[model samples]
Target: MADPVKHYQSEGHDALSAISQAQRIAFAPMLFQASWCLREIGVLAYLEDRGKEGATTAEIASHCAIGEYGAGVLLDMGLGGGLCHLVGDHYVLGKVGKYLQNDPMTRVNMDFTQHVCYQPLAHLLDAIRAGKPEGLQVFNPEWATIYPHLDALPEPARASWFAFDHFYSDWAFQQAQEHVLGYAPRTLYDVGGNTGKWALSCAARDPELEVTILDLPEQLALAQPRIEAAGMTARVTGHGVNMLDAEGPLPGEADIWWMSQFLDCFSHAQIVVILKRIRQHMKPGARVCILELFWDRQSFEAASFSLNATSLYFTAIANGNSRFYHSKEMYQCLREAGFHVEAEHEIPGPGHTLLVARPLPQPS
Candidate 1:
């Protein structure tokens, strides 16, 4: 195998560059909070509306209904952070600022961080030391995993969590549908199907297709209704079970077993268990499709960076044992679970990779 580092693009840095990078790292939290404040306080919105003409500090303060001093402080921070540009006495939204205001992905990510990650992230070191989700205490004290107690999360946080979860995967569904349909499967089992989005999509694609969702009870409550709302209740059904339970029974004979952005929520050992369970239940020649964002397989440095950063979130809150897997790690898990990669498909947009694996024949 070629050196994985060969693909990494490096910016040749001088002493000044190193100093600049160090300063950015040291002040990142402050910059992030300031930018969030700028967006929440209406500074970015007002500037975005103004366009090239921009808005004066006093005008922004009056429009946003805040004191001019506070407004000025945030505006200065925005200017420093490159979120906005200062032209004479007026401020205009920068490229980054416009994204913060208009991008759906940005909105969801920011809200998710604010609601689900921020407080818990503070305890990340503790979580790492304990090898458990120490930060999950912020949401539910009894549950170790976030999925089990998702419904109990405080109002907007719950809303933000689902929105964040769906927004990332929904875009990839259109691409995934084509891959799954190519095999002409009559029955599709959606493991970890949170809100039945994929099931609804499949129902529309093939009316006669039987779609079953396997997830926790709390998740099914949200999914069953959406399936009905999509008028897919006849074709789509929910089966409540914990995928993480090693000894749990799994329904068999599905032609296609699909897991979208789901396996990354587990450790390597757990992934093997889940895959082995699926293999045991699946019919002969059945295919298991795994859709995930593998850090090493990403086309860009930023995508890999974002994924690596998210792995910390898993350590601190999600499961405390899972991470964004490298493609090699996933392959090893598949091999250990008595499966071989039949095909690998790289999906467009946001660096998602799909692995289609087939179960090895069991000995007589």
Candidate 2:
């Protein structure tokens, strides 16, 4: 079946539109910084507060306490970027400007770019050339991947990383709980369960349910106090191990394996290995639920843009070999792991798709 939502046209552009797009790409860095400063320094918010009548540059400068020269340049750049509108001497928030101030996704993306991906992205060319996560050198010289050092990342970077992760996955948790709990699975495995958000939620929701989170030791350490604080220490536990370590095996006690925003952290080959390992350990009748933002499955072009851009972040910082896989690629991995997708669901949020798979019955 063809995907009606997936369409990318390859067409020639006229001279003016071509040049306009080229200029947008060329000045994107400057515009991004300008937008960030405007948001951080209160220019965007001030204009938003001023409403449709907007505010003059003098008023903005006075309110923000920046010099008129500084305010004017940012505001002008905002106009060029369609982030603000200049009518007469007043500056009003454009559609883009409003979202910049009020959108949670925008805020998370900005902070993540600034604190986590910004410096690392400078080494993206090196990473691509070497086919490795060379950009992670920004954080630590010894670490081969970002997962192990997540807890140890510097203040704003660590905060920003979690914020970015949660911003995309958190909204889907409620729907996820409903979907999984409907099956009445007594035991759940939370793979790559950072900080135990899902574990904490599921355990609290079902008195009979127990959750085991499998992640690196550092991440488990961070989740420990939180689980204890939630008074779910008995029901929710952390298993400290690297899922990518082929020699190590997953616990087979889980009635359901839940991986949310997890599988994309590994390459296609690694995804197969991880899935195969899980299949080996899954209890009879157990199911694996995978939640991801598959680029080819996105409903909108903007969502696709975000996921595609995130694939680069994975290459440059998180790990060198993974990507935001297409849905077909994910399905292929499931089949290779000896599981068949029994159901597919669209989580009630942006860019999330869930695949529920069951193990292929063993031959007699």
Candidate 3:
């Protein structure tokens, strides 16, 4: 097999360029904060409105309701960070600034990073040393993971958290819906059905389909009302049980078992256990479909960079054991759980790959 990481094998930058990159990394937090302030304080918006004409520092300050000194300092960092550029004493929004101001993905990522991941990241080293989400204590001292406390997170954190979560998966769902429903399965089990978003979407598409959401009771509590509101109470149901609990009720028989962006929340061993347990109860010839964004599979360096950085969030704020996986790792997990990939499809737009697998034949 060709090397998956061939591009990252050597130092591609000259010494001066390498040092410049180091400086950028060293000042990343400060620059990020400056960019945030630029957006929140409306400097970016004002500059964007000015277009090519741009605006002087004083004009920007006057419009944004801040002192010229405040505006100058933030705009200075913005220039340093390439969020804006000055031409003839006028500041114009740069391409980076435009994306920061306008891109939905960028907006969701920034909000999530600022509101949910920032404070927790301070304890990243401690979490690494302890092999636990030590930073999660910032939200609740008693909680071991952030999943259960998701709904109760304060203010913008809750909103940003869900926005970031749904932004990636929801878009992919639009493309994945057709392929999954194409199986023509009468019953589908949505394992780790966070908020029943996938289950409801599928249920809405196929009138004959009956969907079951398997997830934590806390998540189930949140999903049940949505199902009721959608008037899917009769065909959709919640199975509130932790997959990690070995003694928990096995998933009921289903023609299709779907796990979308779910197994990444678990360690390799945990994933094997969960899949093995599902294998025990899945009906004969039932198929398992997994939707994931493998870091190594991304065509763009930026997308891969995003996925790799997201792994740190898993370590510091999530379960502390799981991360965005490479395709090989997931394939190994499937093999260990007695399945083989029968087909793979790349969903258009968001770079999500869906794997369809069936159980290996059992010994007599």
Candidate 4:
């Protein structure tokens, strides 16, 4: 194929790097809001607003609502990010504007994450200090509360989360597929896989596989339509269960079990107990994939910061263990539960890692 890429020194990439590095608290809210407009910046909707005619800097500033000085900076920053056109005194959306909407595909997703996920997240420092999220009795409201209202939000809000449908699914499934060393895994189970995104992907790629998702009645009720809408009526299936309830595995069998972004709802002891229960369902060759924001110490990025902060909200409001785990720390927990790592992969983009492990081989 023609060269994979043509440009190396992209200012947009660098600007995002700045966004990824700086903590949410460090930037002025104005800049943060501008950055929030990122998905829309180099998108077609922005171009449409120009009506095929470019405008002066003052006009652009008037449109975006800011002073001339600030607008100049915004234009420069957008240019650095490859989202603006500056030809002499006139400006327009950049060439990149053809692809993304002036608004992001996940605008609604951003609102949900920003409003629901970030508020409690911002309280992490306070939680660490006062040791709680405000005066709320619990720290983790994810499973307990998030489930009931997910469908209540408009489709655009849910759709705002671009990662949930494709990228996130791939990140979690590829970890499992690669961890198995490319073998056609026999049986894989995705617990609480709402919308069956990951399960459907796994089943599609490997025809020999059978996958099931266990989730609450309400989520499953809402998710069935989407699953059918995606035409994954057979490759993937669902079951309703209270994940927190004491229970045993499915009646017949399980060779591999996957929990993507499911463990953050409980305490470590609770997770251990859950794993212990899941262990009994394995057929000697089984492995489990745990996908979440297992924190890394090397460096932090914007997505990572957002993810880590989101988890902190879980810790403060629902369960104390809501903050993301360090890799080594999670491995320790896995070890205590009789699982040793078989493989690990950090998916592309940000704020997610996958750990796949089998029950430690028992010796005779």
Candidate 5:
């Protein structure tokens, strides 16, 4: 089928524009199904424990509970999708998918996104505009889900710390601690941390500090296995906490409060309230560190585009907002929460700023 949307934009290179536009319009419908098929077939082949040794589409269909016709259809399209390879009449994972056969590094990512991300991404645009009052319903299709899920966020934050997880973080830990706080504080807490990657890094480098994570039952169920595997169980521990309720206070006051890629799910007032609550749990020298997208007057184009597209997705499915806030604008909010904002650094590509906020001492 010829694409109705052509290379009308003159800004991009002709070759790139023509190919990009055509691909966009060409597989528009398949966008929703593509991930599912790739994941499904990949899992099926893995279940057979066939590494390089392939399986027929009929066998894959039977194992995956999909019809032979459906399996055939997936193979027909998935080959070009870079998800599978065709061996005459038989089908197997392609070069791209060979990684998924038994590699924990490969399969873990697909599972994480399919189970954890697919739902929220289903409504990424909806989350951006909710502005805090309307929360994203990722786990629950009907009810509002927050806090515990928010706690487990750090692992994904860690996994996604860098741009390489292709579509995904050791840096969230480094940024959460060193870059965000700059060693000005003594203790740090990563609320909703998943695998405790941030804390592991923080504790490894700074032996003087203590870090904590709070998350939900389900996320913890998944995170527990990973945390144990990572073997940082001594430095990092989990506390059962829920943020949606009115009474989920910090277990103790700390020198710093860290919310990695957190705080985007609430309204402005909600952010103020959360900060104020942190104020109650904070010591005189406490600090707040946030790793999020911080925009400025002279905006970077790549950062702008990623934020725009992602915010839209947040709004559509999650009924939440990304809140691409400016520096002074964020400082205003921090001031209202009784904190003094410090420096903000913006790296290249859909940038995330390491923002540090030092707490205000008592007034005379």
Candidate 6:
């Protein structure tokens, strides 16, 4: 594999270019908001429909039901941000504008950032100083993290949060399911199984397979209805327990333990503690499968950039201590928890890495 560090090893831009980049960063929030408004207000879509012919500022404003001045200002920012281009007096949708208007990934990311992270990020420095998710006060001052309040989050916030959470993992689930089912495990434990989506999917694939969801009580409550709706209540069950609580009981008979994009929600020290707790209860010869998007293992620099930016969400909103991790840090945590990695598989599409591990042999 090519060294990921090569991307960041040198300053690639001259001073003039560097200053231009810095200025862009300074006004990035304004550009992002302008781009979002253009898409949401139908300006980009109207431009897209106009195609090569494009549309004049008055025509766009009339079609989108906004003032011509408002349209012109946003269009000017869009041009500067590379979201649109001006042809004489007309504006046409650029590649970036088209992406913002129609790309599923971009749409999901934009909404997630807007509804979930944007306002909370204002408290990022406070979160850093307090070593807690201080920004969570944007919703409720008493809540420690966003997980418990996920279902309670208002309309687009809840929708966007789940969409963002599931988008990357959902794409990789098919390949991951096939890989895990290869072991023919009768019982699979899905740690951090929010709403039991993975559990339902796996149960549907294998009739005899019994799946258990281990998560918070609230999440289990949400999953119960879905399990009954799927008519898999018999095959799928919930175990309400917080992984953060060391004293929480973990079932010992499962053939495989699955944690999908779960461990990264925890601090390194917390991860080791959680893993060590699971190590004590895992049955002999059982496998633990961890699926995560390690920033360093990404095939593209853009994927790395997205993952790194997401780390701030964890800090300011989700949980102050945890961030998307590197593969090496996870490996170290596994080893510290008395387990060893037996295999690593890179799930195609979403750039997720699955690490399969087993407990270290007991001393003779």
Best by TM-score: 6
Ranking by TM-score: 6, 3, 2, 1, 4, 5
Q: What tens digits encode model 2's per-residue C-alpha lDDT throughout 230-349?
A: 999889998988887877967889988999999999988899899988988888889999998887777777788888898989999888889898899999999988899999998757
Candidate 6: where are CA atoms >4 Å away?
none
Instruction: Enumerate clash totals for all models, in the order shown.
Output: 0, 0, 0, 17, 34, 0
Error of 6 at 54 (Å): 0.9
* Overall lDDT per candidate, in order of appearance: 0.88, 0.89, 0.91, 0.60, 0.57, 0.92
lDDT of 3 by residue, 147-225 (tens): 8888988988999989998999999997888888888999999999989999999999999999999999999998999
Number of the candidate with higher TM-score, 1 or 6: 6
TM-score of 3: 0.97
Pairs clashing within candidate 1: none
Candidate 2 or 5, higher lDDT? 2
Better of 5 and 6 by lDDT: 6
Candidate 5, 1-364: lDDT as tens digits: 1221232224565887789779967784474366456565555455336546677877787777788887777666767666676666667667665554555544554554444455566454445444431334544445444333444344554343223222323434443455644655466677656556666667667766666776556556655675677676776667666554446766765676777655654546667777777777777666677766644422544444445444443454333543556556667778888877765665433355667777676698
Superior candidate under lDDT, 4 versus 5: 4
TM-scores for the candidates: 0.94, 0.96, 0.97, 0.66, 0.57, 0.98
TM-score of 5: 0.57
Alpha-carbon runs more than 4 Å astray in model 2: 1-5
By the TM-score metric, which is better: model 5 or model 6?
6
Looking at model 3, residue 306 earns an lDDT score of 90
Output the worst ten-in-a-row residue range by lDDT, candidate 4: 1-10
| Residue 319 Cα positional deviation in candidate 1, in Å, after optimal superposition | 1.0
Residues 317-360, candidate 4: write the lDDT tens digits. Answer: 44445556656767777887788888776665444666778888
